[model samples]
Target: MRNDVRALRLSGGLSQAELAGAMGVSRQTVNAIETGRYSPSLTLAVRLARYFERTVEEVFHVDCD
Candidate 1:
């Protein structure tokens, strides 16, 4: 999976920690997601999309093999 999280966060003037705080997750978790080291759960993905005023499809893209 790939996401525009870093770009969105930067455009929104939010640090990883700030984004994490808004999503109620650890900064490390946010970092992991942004870096593609981890994939967020369905619930977290929805929360993230809602926070950015976007749909999940706008925030995340699944790369097909």
Candidate 2:
């Protein structure tokens, strides 16, 4: 999976730490998500969508191989 999290956060004027705090996660977790080093769980994904006020599809995308 690939996500537009960094772009979204930047556009929203949120730093990584701010986004992490809003999502109730660690900054490293957000970094991991942004870097594609980790894939968020469904719950986290939902939380992220809720925080950004966006649909999951708007925040994340399935990258076909």
The number of the candidate with the highest TM-score is 1
The segments of candidate 1 whose C-alpha lies over 4 angstroms from its true place after superposition are none
Q: After superposition, how far is residue 29 of candidate 2 from its true place, in Å?
A: 0.4
* lDDT for position 20 in model 2: 92
lDDT of each: 0.95, 0.92
Deviation of model 1 at 58, angstroms: 0.7
In model 2, what is the error at residue 63, expressed in angstroms? 2.4
Q: Mind giving the per-residue lDDT tens digits that candidate 2 earns over 14-58?
A: 999999998889999999999999999999998898888999989
